[model samples]
Target: MQERPPFKTLFAVPLHCEGCISSVTNALSQVEGILSVECHLEHQLVEVEGTAAPSKISKSLQDIGKDCILRGSGNANSAAVCILETHAPNVENPVRGLARLVQAGPEFTIFDISLKGLQPGIYQASIRQNGDISNGAASTGGVWEEDTRGTEARGRLGQIEVDSEGSGGIILDISVAIWELIGRSMVLSPGTELFRQDDEATLVGVIARSAGIWENDKVVCSCSGKTVWEERVEQTGKGML
Candidate 1:
């Protein structure tokens, strides 16, 4: 197989709005080989991808009066990366829970996560993998993705599996938190390693266990924002309506 291209992610200063994205974009445009820049408004996270050097990226941003946090570094082909944010009111309660998600998939693939299921002050993160697992860490963002000081960690979850088959299956019932208001979802990183009968199962449906992706088929029901990762991926695979 062809080797995957190396990719690095970093967190820039807390941006207040799209204007901030424009600000960083305008400032960083002075650099070269910046393949793409995704500034998530919901997560308050800025992902810059390209041939640009991390140090240079840092220097330029710093010169422009912005700080950056490198989330992770790996080849995009091999590493699927996603971030979990839990910004509950009494956010402290969910800190440890969110950290667990980061530990679950250190070399996490950027899968679709939403926060609709999350309560105002409760937070958790879930990661799905199907091969050798890796450790991960948290930058300075909230567990459910918000502007605040948070923790970073690194470890491994068993692997990514959305469902199970014969012998291997989920070890425990996992919790999913979401917010209908913002169209965000958080897959709770397991408190311990989980097992599934199959490896190809999508994390959303399988991880939810016999009950399915949601307790009662409840999903982040929103028509405004983009369809979530699960819906989009499924629709694409099935050629949906």
Candidate 2:
């Protein structure tokens, strides 16, 4: 397997003093696949460059009692995100998973995905041809085709095995471009089959552009009048892991 190149990910952390910086750096340094760690006490930001999943980094910080939020990732115009949701009427909270895609190089992209509130079983993920989720994954069309050669579906992102607690995640290096996936839809369907349609347990979300490093600096949301941490609480309350 080809080694994945390192990419930068910035996070807004609560840094009060130099000790905080040292602690954050130490925690991240211990994480596997992390190449470098830089903490800015003045800006209260932590910048990590490596092949580590952002979620893993965040969890490490959280384990040390530090609250951190991902501010940006990748390079300009090279990052995207998706919120995988189930549109089944019987399901109260539709959200079931999340996906983050960042272009690590000219020939490949890094895909970090997480799932929660799902049954303990195997599931498959894929990028569909359309962005529509009107009928959940059923409306998203087929898996994205790389070309007309009828070759393998480059958008098939592979399997995720949920634990008994209904959570699972993975970081993958795939041969696809961030630009090619914009405006598409990502589906997480229960089973090992790659082309299964939407079911009650299926989760779907649209691919949307996400901020790159230093691109988003707002600490407060303009529409909600809530700080970033406050927004995080709200999202957490909504079952976003």
Pick the lDDT winner. Answer: 2
Q: State each model's CA lDDT, in order.
A: 0.35, 0.88
lDDT of each residue in 149-197, candidate 2, tens digit only: 3447787778899999999998888988899999999988887786556
Per candidate, the number of residue pairs that clash is 55, 0
lDDT of 1 at 129: 27
lDDT of 1 by residue, 1-241 (tens): 1222335445535678778889888777777757777777665566776545454555577787775544443332222223232332333322211111111123232222222222232212333322112212222112231223222221112332222221111221122221111122223432233222112111221121111101222234376444344554454343221
The TM-scores, one per candidate, come to 0.30, 0.95
- Once superposed on the true structure, which residue ranges of model 2 sit more than 4 Å away at CA? 146-151
Q: What lDDT is reached at residue 71 by model 1?
A: 41
Off by over 4 Å in 1: 1-8, 76-241
